[model samples]
Target: MHADTFGTFDDTLASGPRRTPLHALHLRRGARMVPFSGYDMPLHYPAGLLKEHLHTRAGAGLFDVSHMGQIALHADDPADAARALEALIPADILGLRSGRQRYGLLTDAAGGIRDDLMVARFGDRLVLVSYTTLRAPETGADL
Candidate 1:
């Protein structure tokens, strides 16, 4: 598998890398650690990459994605939040039904994609999930 599929890394943090909630459990399972998106994440376990991949394909696997970003958008009307979000990303936010989720992208002025994100429509709000690395300033600035 490609390394990018594992996760992206950002090594520019001044306070060193942060740890996920499963950090200790990963260590206990003999996982090899790597820096990913400002967080210390597991690269592989004692079973190794290939074995883990095979096992996952054959049965099941659980991933720790707590390092990803989650943002909740709330407005007086849920449609208002949807309309606001549609101004930034290329998605049919207004058309999305409640309890539904849609994949979308954040693009720059020149139409270059900045990041991939998921927008979920709840009863009273829209919840966005994005990559931790690029969600800080750019996405925050736009919203």
Candidate 2:
């Protein structure tokens, strides 16, 4: 069967579900695509989830998470930006040095995790990346 049978390839416009840069490659490799967040994401390959999981457990796996949210926080002082972010998440953003990254959790007022994220400190800014379902605009607005 054709790979297109796995998912529709209607990613020609800017308004609907967005396609990652690797969309075509995924189709060629028999990735079953599904709508995720606002993007067309691969659910699995032709190998099936169980076999793929076992294969990865036995060795390694490459995940395509290009559809995840990425928000960049910039300020006159990077430390200031980090401090601002520190108020929201549980990570020590202020202690994150340049060229370093840390895993963090976005928590509710009661200390429940709302989302998991990765914070990376560049020289001039801190970039926050959220998981697949978290959109950049929503996460940025929350911060």
Candidate 3:
């Protein structure tokens, strides 16, 4: 679809791009590689976005999410961990059941978003997949 978040150049084909865990698989599948978030992510494969979207909706598609930061929080009890996390975030982490995951935002005390994270509850730990670092509101000066 849109290419704004995709790589910057085709001329840098000879230049090395950061690879992900699925880089080899993407090449084998004819994926169009693009620089994204400091990684060479696949923009689309031979199937293209439409076909990929359809197939993913109908079945499954392997995605490279290695660009995200992952962290694990462990406690003697899962509820303890959830409570600790809820203290920092406004999310209802305590409401999550084992084997369940939910999307939530990590907000600052002033309500500014620090980051968006996916939290999954396991036995006695929470696995957090953070999308990115804090995104401060853009100032007009940057424009």
Q: How many clashing pairs does model 3 include? A: 0
Q: For residues 7-109, write the lDDT of model 1, one tens digit per residue.
A: 2334455488888879999999999999886788999999889999999999999888777766667566777777777877888989988788888987887
lDDT (0-100) at residue 143 of candidate 3? 8
Better of 2 and 3 by lDDT: 2
Off by over 4 Å in 1: 1-14, 54-61, 97-100
Query: Which lDDT values do the candidates have, in the order given?
Result: 0.72, 0.70, 0.62
- Tens-place lDDT digits, model 3, residues 72-124: 66566667767766865678988887788888777666887767767777665
| Per-candidate TM-score against the hidden true structure | 0.70, 0.66, 0.73
Per-residue CA lDDT of model 2 for 59-90, tens digit only, reads 99987766666666657677777777787787
Residue 49 deviation, candidate 2, in Å?
A: 3.0
Q: What's each prediction's clash count? A: 0, 0, 0
The collision pairs in model 3 are none
Question: Which candidate number has the best lDDT?
Answer: 1
Model 1 superposed RMSD (Cα): 7.4
The top-ranked prediction according to TM-score is: 3
Model 2 poorest 10 in a row by lDDT = 1-10
Can you tell me which runs of candidate 2 are displaced by over 4 Å? 1-16, 54-60, 97-100, 131-137
